[model samples]
Target: MSILPQLAFVLILGAAGLILRKRILFLKRNILLGKDETRNDQPNERWKTMFLVAFGQQKMFKRIIPAFLHFLIYVGFLVINLEVLEFVLDGILGTHRLFAPLLGGAYTVAINIFEFLAVAVLVSCVAFLIRRNVMQVERFTKPEMKGWPAMDANLILVIEIILMFAILTMNATDQILASRGDEHYLALGPLFFSRILQPIFMGLSDGALVFIERFAWWFHIIGILAFAVYVTYSKHLHIFLAFPNTWYSNLKAKGEIQNMPEVTQEVNMMLGIPVENPSAPPAEIGRFGAKDVNDLSWINILNAYSCTECGRCTSECPANLTGKKLSPRKIMMDVRDRAEEVGKSIDAGGPGLEDGKSLLGDYISKEEINACTTCNACVEACPVNIDPLSIILQLRRYVAMEESGTPAQWNAMFQNMETSFSPWKFSPSDRFNWSEKVKEEEMK
Candidate 1:
């Protein structure tokens, strides 16, 4: 019935709950306004998705060592919450531990077990930090590599190290309290560092040691709460977003583009992309494709927010490396910016908007769409499995279906699609054209 530990538990739980609540509410509001339904209608697929993305970490494996470290950290961090629960109960309830009974005589054995896991978690995080700092993987690159805030990449490593040390400090304090003596032998994991400082505890009288134990106990709780709040605001927002994005990723079909309405042949439409907007749309077709953020489906917007901005897409983008006017990172940023503009305009009855025209003209340009090779590199590179190809394809549909406009190469390919069932432009009747040479060789 100690009040200090109870207070610490309440503070940690309350702060974590508040941060989680706010994040969930924001995500829900966006989903309701977005196009696709966030709910999973397919039960079988949902289970498959949960296993593959959550348990498997399939996408992360594309880059071996870092992915392996990330997987270990993620799994260990989640499961180690069991150890945290034991601390809270033992610290407050004066109980030996909650898990020991469930785990049998192996209660201390389990503690000894997680002590090793704690060390593994610590080592993995250190490896991750080294990878980000020294190797400078493409995914970790920031605007400034070695300056103030030391880049977000470095900050992430620092946060992880702090959390681990905080946990170790708390464990060391607990050992000192239980043993009522120097923690010389029980030192394990990072607690070994605290063990080396056992001389300080030996120097202090019992009254001073009691105060240190209580303060360290509360400090650990406060640290957990602060980490929760940090997670909500940081680039590590991916910790929250990655799960949902993977659950909802397009698993059923990879190549199919969503259908846009037929604007090209609409009888009443005289001035759309192909006709009225000449230079912007096309002389013959008027207007087509995304003019602004609203023209995009809800899925496109989800892709924007869901991007970890890990730079995986940028690293693999053909247009980005080739010096073309496209970068998937920029595309995601444009979608976010355009969506915010349209939202403000709508809120202000269009007064906040400078132009009366659609968002495509002001936000995403036709040239940006054309820059994409539709190579699926971005699709393959994304750790959370985002499909930039689908977004580009949707824009392609906007152009081909509405404007009746395309590059000469695309036009020829489409013509072949209509006449030959293939993109090679050969007649269907000439299907066996290559067979004649093979037949002559066989006769010889």
Candidate 2:
């Protein structure tokens, strides 16, 4: 209950706020570096998507066991963080249990519920760690998950375990001190999990008990604050980004490819479709498609940040399943990596960075792009509604239109589509020849 502690609390909060603000701004800037596209329409549908996909975890439920475990952690983390509001108030005012008097009996209930959730979170985190490390789940140990991705997954699980332990420790010591009738300790009957731990702290001196309680309390709050900041730099950013990403998710039919407006206009003109403003000056032609992150739509870039790297998309991808170089998860990671590189370069100098590298060659490869069948499996598999296929299509477009780099067989197919109106070497009039042959065979 000192001014010094209150001041220190304010300083810590301010520092965390400042760093978090900078990180958020950096992410926003990087995401917006991509070309702008409208995804703001259909507000109702967007909200429904956010609710079902992000909040309800609709896609996650496809796998029941993992889904149930994830639900516990998700709910526990969000619910437990509600206590942070009281922690903040107490820290700023140098008051202990600031909400205890206001809530009266309900305070005990809330604390007990929080302790239950804390224990659940600890157990769930441990289970996830075992699944990732001990069980070595195939989806988790894919080549893309080798270094930082693997370590990051384990680190977050460990951090959650430690934070949950801190919570229990704080509550247990506080309960012990309250039983001893220590000043400033609230007599909140007993938190279930903490009550179980109370025996460990028995017989400790009043001052020692107080010190342990204070240490746990400070550690829990500070750990939460640090986790908040760390998530922005980690794949766990999906925890926050999933909401908006799902809200702005593509609502168009999965098989329907989005046509380029410039190309559409040119085609309309070529077909003599009674174009309006025929005398208008021609629009400047930019790159045909996304050669770099900047050429992609902002939503596409946002998808990269929103990716959980769970490899569900890769697991479902036909390309990856059949010994192809393309991994949908890797595509997302590469886009994020490239975006961060470009964002940092621009932050350091100015606009363009002549890094002599691009998302296409340096980060992602043409082979990977061509490997995609565009079956929409990856998009469908994404729990947060990320459209890695959209990025893939854009990159493929760049390869086809800008570089004319399609393989010989693909180029032949393209020529057939243009001249024969089908991906076959035959005249348009002969398109039904196979059908006639099939009918004759059936008759025989």
Candidate 3:
């Protein structure tokens, strides 16, 4: 009969595991729907990038207040999860304070630290809630963040705050029960932060205190499990994806645009540039660039799914600053939305990418892509190292290569660059005249 609670716990955990596995598969399948591209060149560099950017929260320091607050929550939440480990073991073994007797003094110290961190996490979350909602931060209030995105951000914060409260509540009630000489509740020294709440619960009966403690324990664990599953669908999916996203981030110089191998090879053949390997296979070329989620690389789609939709990229974009339609943030969101739409359709026996809808025109507009200055501001601004410009370039490639011709001004620049080796109308011979004219003006 005592094992019944343990059995129920096992069942609940197993269900959560199954649901989490389903979400993982759904995310993976949608991401893999994209074309393959090589992003696995440097293991050491990738690890460093992940460590510095994701684990270390290095880039987030650009805005110190939010970064510090976020770091407190990030670090505190992680540290406090150690206590959660004890909670899980207690649940499974059907024991109260399972680690307390084993670790003794160390367990008390550990939980005290966890309690302190829990308080820190609680405070940090409240600060973030105010910054995001009450303060109405500009980056957070963008058009893409209007509905679900905004609510998801707030909801995650609220969940964390509530979970922190559950921890404090459990500890306070456990302390009270311990004082009352409850056999099951071992007195784990003073959890200083939670002790402040002792007076409030002191008036409660021992039975009531035990019930509250048990309820809070269950609540904390259940909330964590549910939060894990909810994150896959939330912008907080970055919680899992940031590591991989930063690792696979573009390693080359930011402004150095990637050229099509097919186009490069063709140009090389025309220039009589010797082929490095004569026996090598010819470059593969099909649809010029991304028309839909199907047209982008797996990493690109991964980038879409990994997107936090924080609007940092859009907020930093020069075009967006100039009141252009281009929100680099929106481009990523559109790709993710299109991928989900297509993935669901294919799963439902619908037309998939061929359903007369595409990522190019139907989801992301031509004006949005065209408005990009390609200044790489969005790329630089992304905290998790998400490359929105890479996605933008691919969409632009479809317009130029497949759909034929970019904006008229871009066409003129392309023509000039090909003929005169410049983006101006001047002939190659007269290109030096500008330098001479500069010299003449200096003399005058």
Q: Which stretches of candidate 1 lie over 4 Å from their true place?
A: 1-12, 37-42, 87-105, 142-150, 181-212, 261-294, 333-368, 395-444
lDDT of 2 by residue, 1-444 (tens): 359989999999999999999999999999998997988889999999999999999999988888989999999978987999999999999999999999999999999889999888889999999999889988898888999999988889999999999989999999888888887898886577888887888979989989999999899889989999999999999999999999999998999989887887788899989666779877787799899999999999899999988899999998899889899999999999999999999888955546878999999988898899999999998999999989999998899989999899999999989988889887889767779888999999
How much does each candidate deviate from the true structure in C-alpha RMSD?
Answer: 7.4, 1.9, 2.3
How well is each residue in 1-444 modelled by candidate 3, as lDDT tens digits? 379989988888899999999889988999999998888888899999999999999999998988898898888867887877887888888988888899999988988888888988989999989989999999898888889889988999999999999999999999888878888788887788899988999888888887899899889999999999999887788877988999999999998988777777777878999866757888667788888888888998888888888788888898888888889999989999998898888889999878999998898988999988889988888889988888888889999988885889999999999988999988788756769878989999
Each candidate's lDDT (Cα)? 0.63, 0.90, 0.88
Per-residue lDDT over 1-444 for candidate 1, one digit per residue giving the tens place of the 0 to 100 score: 457756656666776788878765554444334444444678678777757875678878888877888877777677767777776676556454456557665665655555556666778878877777787775456442335324554666676666666555555555665566443223222334455446656666656765766566556556665666665444465666667677677766555555444444453256443444334542344235554444555766666666656677877888877767666765675665555555556555784335575444465566777899878788878887776776666667667777766688889998889788999978899988999999999999
- Model 3 regions more than 4 Å off: 270-284, 418-421, 434-444
Off by over 4 Å in 2: 350-352, 432-444
Q: Using Cα atoms with residue i matched to residue i, what is each candidate's TM-score against the true structure?
A: 0.71, 0.96, 0.94
Which candidate do you rate higher for lDDT, 1 or 2?
2
Better of 2 and 3 by lDDT: 2
lDDT of 1 at 39: 47
